[model samples]
Target: MPDQAPVRSSALPVSDWQQALDTVLQTPVKARPYSAQIMRQSPTAFLFLIDQSGSMDERTTYRGRVLSKAAAVAQIVNQTLLELALRCQKGDEVRHYYDIALIGYGGLNDEQAVSLWSGAAVGKFFLTPAELAGATLRVDEVTVERNIRGRAVTVTEKRPVWLNAVHNYRTPMKSAICLAESLVGQWLATQQGNDVYPPTVINITDGVATDATADELLACCDRLKALRSMDGNVLLMNIHVSDERGNSILFPARADDLGTDQYARLLYDMSSEMPTPYHADIASLFGLDQRTSYVGMCSNADMDALVKFMNIGTPTQHNHSFTANLSSEP
Candidate 1:
């Protein structure tokens, strides 16, 4: 480490979910349009790092039947990414301002870990989130079963469904991050020579670092913050999942606002700005004139508690004041 000190970002502290949403909503277009393109020299990119270690195989009751935490997360992220990837002029499943890369980590039967490949890696039928969302899952519904004190009840409920997002994974999240670095490096090289900068990277995880790869993950993300082009810079956002509960398990349970939880506030603090197009639009969707929101999932109280303690996204105290600190350092 240099005598200079670590880079501190300029994000704001959140008070609740609504506050986070408000910030998210306002992030893209305060001054004008083309927020996405304005932010990224070329099309923006969003990478989803989903944790699929074997630990995720642990089954728990939702409605009535048992389901794994990995399954639930895969569904949510898949749906979100598929939706995020919009139609470009090509008429194919191309994104106008958003491009997605679904990286799976910790799912393996071998000795080495950190399998950070796209969604199609589990199979070859389809390759992207758009394709995965269109695929069918073995189970269409999750049975909602909850134990109040000790009693167990079963109920079957259908969600959008997911396929191949997870399978035979282990907990080498950090190792997966190393792979992420390599892929990202390749991507950056291609972009740098062309003078294009992407938007952000989104990471979704379910457990702690057994591989002790936080530094690697942070390093990869840090590189993201450094990427600059005619637009602005790339950002890396982290989404931590407990993959246990339904509505109540997540902070600021109400989607309408984000002003209630300390954890929610921290999440926003670490959140990257929305892609340019979404900047003004997301706020419009939330009916917040100018604000951002914090969005994430947790499996249960234990998971929620853990996320609260573990910081995500960009921390507060970010200042682009010092030129040296503001510039990319690798």
Candidate 2:
């Protein structure tokens, strides 16, 4: 036989995900892709899917100090949440304006992510406030240690803060995406019940697909679109981080900045634009401008990525969509 192009793996375990897509497409599933309830009324939900793969521990030294990748990420995440909280529009608290969830992927499997606010071991849906401030969460730290007392403790001090967030679990990046899709789908359905925009999901990854998944990503996103057609607010952004430099690589756009990687940029874009001076430094440290609103994306991450995702709904004015990648080059 003549040589042929190699087949691209069907990002999912074949028909299992496809079956879900078929069912979703056929049945007018409610726009609650985030919560599993009905939200035909809210404006949107904000979600973060991060890559905690071993590679996240990228090493760098400053002032005779060694920083692991995960630790760097923790700082960014801390800031992200604080900005998110501080910048939320007037009268908007954590309960409304957003139902944020964080999912981390890299080290464990099935034991994926848990909500920092509610501390819920998640398979479906996001975490609650009580769950977000678990034993593992702290808004700020003063020291940096990967092996704290020989234990894996990264965030020694926090420049940013922690919101009820999620962490990466296992080593699969694509599985996290699957979860993101399901969550976003559920949130959108519910938001519609409350007359909302459905949520925006952002994902970040350093490695390629560990499990088969992605076909469902597009299909799932398409399903999210089905909820509102043109006026809908649901958006999904993915960022692929390379073992590149420290700065963010830009995904330039004419009216907006859009990138290709999908994971890292999502974080940069989703942050709140209007923050109190308390969060303004952190927000400004990231690419966020006081003029723009953002949807989310994946990121190569820094102190900036986390700030953006947590504050997705902070500003009263809604944000549009944004980039996905690592480093500041975008």
List model 2 lDDT by residue over 37-143, tens digit each. 21212334567767776666666332345675566555555555554444332443333334667666654443343332222332324543323434233344567
- Each prediction's whole-model lDDT (CA): 0.42, 0.44
RMSD of each predicted structure: 14.8, 12.7
Residues 12-60, candidate 1: write the lDDT tens digits: 2323333433333333322332232212234444555666777777664
In model 1, where is the ten-residue run with the lowest total lDDT?
1-10
Q: Cα RMSD for candidate 1?
A: 14.8
lDDT of predicted model 2? 0.44
